[model samples]
Target: MSGEEGAVATETPLAALGETMDLMTALQLVLKKSLAHGGLARGLHEGAKVIEKHAAQLCVLAEDCDQPDYVKLVKGLCADHNVNLLTVPSAKTLGEWAGLCKIDSEGKARKVVGCSCVVVKDFGEETEGLHVVQQHIKSH
Candidate 1:
């Protein structure tokens, strides 16, 4: 192949991969902030409950989640309440990041629910990560 065609072919997939990695990195940051601070509520039920009370600042949903009704309900509530919505790549990954797993007494892992809502009530002095995630979502 010609040098131009070879360069195009090589760069196309890498560019797509880069975008995917960037989103994953951003998702991790959001998750970390949500967990470390007192602003996180994990799982579809918890998130929806917070949204129902108009207490959510932002909502993140895993794009690969199997629960369509969960996504639909959260999306509708977010739109109605003017909360920001974000999509990650996988529910499992998001669950791990949100610490939605527990090690049983038998040393086996149990998966908890997925999805999360970031509450803004206790934002306090740590707003950097929040702004970064908000900006990232807006740009995307």
Candidate 2:
């Protein structure tokens, strides 16, 4: 029994350019624990919806072949919507998110480079980032 190879190979590319990896990674911890404590299917479904709402492109990285069945559902949505999804640098979701966040120089917001996968077009260095985040959230 091995982990899903495909899932472990893809790292969140946004992680390198932004700050939301921390939030994403932390959610993995909560989700995994929830699953272990009897919250896998229902809880994961709810969380996945929230993440999907927030994330413009949802990347579902697999830890191994034994990846949870629930994640498969999320991946199906991603496929249907044509959202860019990747699976690599895998771990229990949160572990991987933390891993990516550590590398994100801009992984913060609210004067801290907040972590959301939204960006302003044609904006320069003088842009108000929080506003950008708000707009990004609104657009989706």
Candidate 3:
């Protein structure tokens, strides 16, 4: 991530771990809120607002699934518009989170109405905040 498009990728495990930890915390917080509030609509709404705010400087990790169309659409649009897209390894965490999302769809749990959205929101805000702190610390 040293070349073009303003990439700043780091290959350090600790750095990646820190990112995961921070993101998990944010997800937990948002999940708790959604559970308490009895729906993922409010949670996703809050996430969208945060994502819109940090659209320029964030890499969103979307969970991959058999339904690649919708997954890539959301992530790709964000990327085409300049937001970064990172695909995560699909797992039960995402599935369970979706189950908790309070969606009324009978199709599948692929709706952007659950933990993935929460993680996207968490990634945006936390990553943006960390970047701001990094810039500040560097300047001073």
Candidate 4:
């Protein structure tokens, strides 16, 4: 994928943006693992609600989220709750990895353009992958 809006490719677009590519790859891996561990919350509303209740352990805000306020809310909530926040360069990619993929009636993959988060209720095996994500967030 070229990381351009409206691109139909489903491949990870990690080759064109130097350090950003690295960040995207690392986040993508974490999202995949988090999904497998059933610790993900997909979409802006869901993420915000989770954060509002102080349930999220780590949050991934796509850099291209459709709603700017979504980003602000997530950031402030994360700060207030001491949850880690990381940014993925593309919302589409983040959505796909977080199991939010959908196909339109026209048979095209719909873009995931909102915020996604990892909600952990307790510190257990489900949060094992969060350590890697936290390391990446600190470096960025």
TM-score to true structure, per model: 0.64, 0.31, 0.34, 0.61
Candidate 2 on 20-97: residue-level lDDT in tens? 434344344333333344422222444356445654333434444354564576566566655544343434333333
* Greater-lDDT candidate between 2 and 3: 3
What is the per-residue lDDT of model 3 for residues 47-89, given as tens digits with 9 covering 90 to 100? 3454466533333344644556655555755655655443335
Model 4 lDDT, full chain set: 0.64
Better of 2 and 4 by TM-score: 4
User: What digit string (tens of lDDT, one per residue) describes model 4 on residues 1-140?
Assistant: 35564454433343333433345555566676667667677765677777788777777777876677767777888888888777767766766777666779885557654444444333334332445556676787
In candidate 4 the C-alpha lDDT for residue 99 amounts to 66
**What is the alpha-carbon lDDT for the whole of candidate 1?**
0.67
Question: What is the per-residue lDDT of model 1 for residues 19-96, given as tens digits with 9 covering 90 to 100?
Answer: 334556655655656676767787766777888888887777778767678678878988999887887777766777
Candidate 4, residue 115: the lDDT equals: 42
- The RMSD (Cα, Å) of candidate 4 is 8.7
Q: How far out, in Å, is residue 110 in model 2? A: 27
RMSD of each: 11.6, 16.1, 14.4, 8.7
The count of backbone overlaps in candidate 4 is: 0
TM-score of 2: 0.31
Scored by lDDT, the top model is 1
